[model samples]
Target: VEPKITLTDKELQAEISELCKYAALLDDSQLEVQVKDGVAVLNGRVASSYQKSYADLLAYRAGAKEVDSRGINVHWRHTNPLLRAQRYEKVTDEDIQAAIQRAFKHDPRLLSFEPQVKVEHGVVTLTGDVGHLTAQQAAEQDALHTIGVQRVKNNLRVRWPDEPASDEQIADYTRAAMTRDPYVERHNLNIECENAHVSLYGVVDTQFEKYHAEWIASRQKGVVHVNDYLAVRTKWKPKSDAAIEADLKDKLAYAFVDPDNQVTAKVENGVAILQGTVDTWYMWQTALDQAIAAGAREPHCLIEVRYGLPSGPHYYGPHDYVPR
Candidate 1:
């Protein structure tokens, strides 16, 4: 027998509130829901392209028997993606670094190798220069599982000194190593060699490249040491302002591929300037990449990520903050 008493308006509102609470927990902004005529209608925005999707995730979790989500807006940034990306590298180098540091401090066998981690906008870039691939991968996996990291960019490559090579072979090996760098390969950063050592006097926009170069130099067979003077140079190369403008426009597509973040770049004499509004740290990194890839020589990107708004002390300062 069906219950005789129908649920009151107040009861429905309370139930809706409870369900929305779960949505808040999921941090899913995919839909805004409404209950009317004993039916739940959902409307909002989602980033996935799948129409027949699991987006009813929160609705189902919250006990919606019949959910209508046709009104929800679908949004996606990349259409013709670079590849069928199984995943995008998202973990920051910092989160992984802290994880490794704490893990080793707690357990003894981890210190035989040097570990490098860089976190920029929640994405971690791992470059283990210990010359042991096994240890490098292990350290990277440790960082991937660390809290607060959304993705990982495995830039960890095997070093030369540990790869069985002579001192003379080391110089040629170092040059070869420098060329293999994605940033170097993509023509993102510039390199110059003096003696057996190489001076990577270039500006890199992302913190990933900043530390990546360091790791490469630290582990190269012949390199005694790399000069840290090669800061994250975001300066662009250009003779005329018009040339700078041209370069900036050309590079915009590389970094600002995501339509949501509106970013523009301009370069003059190797100094790159970026301006635009972005909602997150990931977008900020993209802007930096754009500046460097646009034929900038040691590009110095002075782009704003969050308008430099000061937050509460407890609030993390993104890249500046190292997790406890």
Candidate 2:
């Protein structure tokens, strides 16, 4: 078990700032941190919402009980112009590829696997074999979230070590895992396994729980793929479509400093549909997150990315990146 972090507020503020500085994506963010009690507040401008997420993660790692990152703004054009050209410090495809390899080395799930990496422009491709499905997914996530990476092509194959477990054994193990997990244990989930493919069928309270169930199912040995069919149960009373849309718009405006209101939210039959254009994947993701927080369960995002660079081929869809 990891030791409990008990840093003082002042020390935690410094620690978070230092940690942010060490991250490649946050190097140019110039973020400022303020800590009071156990809450850490971050204020600065970041190029992408991914960088803001990384900064928040660092704050929590530095012992902050609650992270207030709303003060930090996401500017699609926040990078230093000189650093991209005159300073000769722009991140290259080779740099991104190397960073991903280092990330894999640091990741406990990927330390034992050496997946082949190839980069072109800002796109990365991972092609190799891993002993489990989790490692394969981790490889893709690491590459996809890396700074300067626009998209990831995960062609990595998952090959189980030794003999693959029988479908019955796989289901038993997955069901046991769900029982052991605190998030989905009491949710009365149903699991089925066929040819090493795990299927999760149940209702979770939130998207986090739904994803957590799928995550646990995928970790089982001999599991090749997880088909997540878990539905999110709406705990709150149903609201009218207009009410939901109004709530979504209010949440988005509060979450972002979008003067032009690049993203729009609409509701149809109690479901929220987000439509608009944003400059980067992070903005698009933040819109979805805000929609869910505004009581739009399983919202459909129809937002388009307006980044100048050409997007990678649609591996899962037409979007630049798929939210895990």
* Local distance difference test, each candidate: 0.50, 0.72
lDDT of 1 by residue, 1-324 (tens): 322224453454345443332221222342456766445577666556452254454343334455687886676642323221211243234534554455433222235665666777667776656544345555665555454556778776555454455434544455467678776444333333344344443344567877776677656654544544344544444456566567668767655666766777665565666666665544555555555555555344444445322121222333221001
**Roughly what TM-score does model 2 have, to 2 decimal places?**
0.54
Error of 1 at 311 (Å): 11
The TM-score values for the models, in the order shown, are 0.27, 0.54
TM-score leader? 2
Residue-by-residue lDDT tens digits, candidate 2, 1-324? 542447788877776765564455565677889999879899988899898898887677566788999999998988865543421246778777777776675566886788999999888889989988889998888776566777899999888868888777887788788888888787665455666777665456789999888888888888889878666756656777787888888888776676554778788776677788877555665776676667765567677765421212221335422121
